[model samples]
Target chain A: MNLIEILSYGFIQRALLAGTLIAVLCSVLGVFLVLRRLSLIGDGLAHVTFGSTAIALALQLYSAASLLVSLPVVLLASLGILKLTEKARLNGDAAIGIVSAVGISIGIMLASVGGGYNVDLLSYLFGNILSISYEEVIIAAGLFCVVMVLLWLFFHDLLAISFNEELARVSGVRTNLISAVLVMLTALSVVLAMKLVGIMLISSLLILPAVSALQLARSFRACIVLAALQGGCSVVAGIFVSFLTNLPTSAMIVMINLLFFCCSCGVRRLITIRNIG
Target chain B: MPVEIVATERLACGYREGYVLEDISFTVNAGDYVGIVGPNGSGKSTLVQALLGLVPISSGSARLFGSRCDNFSQWGRIGYLPQSLHLLNPIFPATVAETVALGLLSLKRFPRRLTRQDRETVETTLDVLGVYDIRSKLIGELSGGQQQRVLLARALVNDPELLILDEPTAALDPETRERFYHMIADVNRSRGVTVLLVTHDTGVIGQHASKMLYLDKRMLFYGGFDDFCHSPEMSSLFGEHSQHLMCHRH
Candidate 1:
């Protein structure tokens, strides 16, 4: 089939729909991750998921049923690390590094012990956008709805906690609950969106969109909205461009986000200078 | 009155260790202007934090409006403008309007998010501080003096009965600091808001504060400004060289 015909196929259409949903969700979360300076938490949790999938595969598991059974386990592990970081008052970058290294090592051990070299493992590591299935797409969509609803209901609380935790606590916000939920939301988002851009590039989609939105976004609410829009456009456009040139979708999406980040950085510098002048 | 506004007895205040300032007792009337002055490391800030429930009381009791300081849920009734209003990054995207609205987080008991009344109060406070023109401006873009005004407005937006300003004028130039002192006087006199101001500027306090609490590792004196300046303790605290700046208070 010709390139245009391939792109217009029903499977391609479904893939785009799913990718867009993932983009929307990741982008919304990316702003907070960047704002909270928890970009590495998302990256760390993605590594944790790798260990989870490795465990699932070593036991001969395939697909959603296995992911369902193991996701909680994976989430709990991330939560443990998050709690540890808070309790021990560790530097956030250090904590993410320790967790990432340990989890990836454990996953490598698991994969080697399984007596098989699976190419599917590599696919999940870096994403196989065209190879995304309908079931995972549905799961991603469901998760997107839940995350969005939670964000909506707790918008004020999230805003309070994100800006200043001590102030939020003094103002009677349940900062611990809200914070845990925020981290979990990041965990869930990384899982769903990692399928499109892989773990390494997922934060790019999340952080870049939010950074760009920061140029114009006044409030936390505006930041999230702008992030989602920037992410959605990047995904759709990236997918189209990648399709035309037969480039990797992950690389294309990340490149697009990087471009936006550079532009916003320049704009922010200009605005700051103008204000100073 | 029906409920005591603030009551503390033998209050020993500190962050987490033993104590910074020990054996303190005081009660403030609803509309009194109390200024705390001390040399560096005198536990002045720690004592204020204890009163604000941000620090642990190593011993004795601290209460706000008849409840323990920790349980004082009426956040709107007590406002605090910390020493460094610029503690937050300038790159942060909060505008003057939005920063002030944070004070409304305690206003969940009120019907609306931010009523027209709240907005007017904010504007009036900013105007009273003489920085109403910068209402739409990003807080990061403000001068140090302007930023303090914004922080002061945020503190007052909830219409608290008791305003606690910790060196609110510390970073301002002398003229700006003079203006802030005037604003504090206006808020206390016209609005009948009780004000507790903490500063190292003893001269300013002697001139303006109705009540002055002096400290050097401990409170050397606590009473009307007239009594504070005349005392030998005040003389000792200021030392012999500061003789001219501090005179017998009337």
Candidate 2:
């Protein structure tokens, strides 16, 4: 079918809406994570979601039910990773590595024991955009609103904490509570985006747009705004390209984001050279 | 009697592993330009953190503005310039103005939007610190001294009654450091804002600070600069070199 014809389908519309919202959510939260040097936490949480999904599939749970099951698990894992790195004195990357390894192992073991890679499981592992439901679209939209509102309400506190946690705390920004909320929001975003980008490429959605925006934006506010714009544009473009090329939607989306990152790097280099000259 | 802005009685604080500070007792009253001097790993930062409520006091009590540290919620009344501001992410995306505005914005309630007065305050602060020219410039693009001044502007924007700085001049050159101290002295004198400056430069303390806090894992000396120069602890800690330095200053 042609582009207009494909747009007529409710599933396609749902996928596009959900994908765009997830992109915006991920990019906004990604700015904070990247600034705080916690970008890898996205990968860790995504892996945990994979493990949770595997368990749900093993128990013959519905897709929505499986997502519900995974939500709390992922949130706990996010907090656990933070505690491990902070109080337990484990390096951030090391903590992420340990958690990610356990998650993937659980997923692999469960997938093997529960009658091999089924169609539903395969779709979740490597996202199938056509399979996105109307319910997920509504859920993604709801989550996008929540994330945006919270980020708005806590923008200054988050910025202060990201810049200097100690000073933010001293300024009475409730550093620990804000950080915990940030991690929880990140977890929610990761889980919400799983269907659109799947486990392997979920972190790309979180890191790429923000990194690209950082290459061009000079201020924190500009960085966040540009990241959201980049993320939203890339998602729409990726979905269109995937529709035209009949490629895996998740992979196509990541590839488009990668392209944006490369272009941004080149632009940044040009700007720096121009300024020097 | 002068109002006690910061009072810690036998304060002991440490991390999960061990105590960095033990039996630390000191009091900073209003309008006091107190310079806290200590060697590396001397719990100077930890002590400041304790007062700011960033670190928990394992023993004794810490008070800020007459309220117990744990229960103190009036952070807007105090300004803090952490030592790590100079070591911030190299590509951190913030303009000098935005960075300074954070000082005021952080104190406001949620959905914190800058008011006209807040903008004026930020501008005046940047102007005071001589960083107004670079207000729109990215913070990462500025030099170390410039960045330090920007951070100072942020700390001053709130009009805080108590200013706590942790080695803020560590990254600046001698000329900038001298100027920075003079600016701080001006703030303390003109605004009646209490200053608690953590530094390694005993010489600067002698020249600029009215009171001195000498720390070496514990309170070695806490008194006027003249007394610190004549104290037995100072002589024992630095031997004859401290006396020589003190003499050279006079």
Q: lDDT: which candidate is best?
A: 2
- In the range B74-159, model 2's lDDT, one tens digit per residue, is 98898888875545788789899989998995478866778888889899989988999999899888888898888888888899
Q: Stretches of candidate 2 above 4 Å error?
A: B15-18, B84-86, B231-238, B247-250
User: How many residue-pair clashes does candidate 1 contain?
Assistant: 1
Q: Worst lDDT window (10 residues) for model 2 chain A?
A: A115-124
Looking at model 2 chain B, which ten-residue stretch has the lowest summed lDDT? B241-250
Which regions of candidate 1 fall more than 4 Å away from where they truly are? Answer: A1-7, A216-221, A268-277, B1-3, B14-18, B109-131, B233-250
Q: Write the per-residue lDDT of candidate 1 for residues B1-250, one digit (tens) a residue.
A: 6335677788776655456887787778888888998778988878777877776777889888788987678776877788655355555666687777777677664222556787777777778767788877777778888888888887787788888888788788999888888888889999989888989887777777788877665666788887755667667757855744654322
List the TM values for chain B, per candidate: 0.88, 0.93
Give the per-residue Cα lDDT of candidate 2 at B167. 90
| Model 1, global lDDT | 0.76
For candidate 1 chain A, which ten residues in a row score worst on lDDT? A163-172
TM-score of 1: 0.89
Please, what is the whole-model Cα lDDT of each candidate in the order they appear?
Answer: 0.76, 0.86
| Model number 1 iRMSD | 3.3
TM-score of each: 0.89, 0.95
Pairs in steric clash, model 1 = A30-A206
Best by DockQ: 2
lDDT of 2 at A32: 94
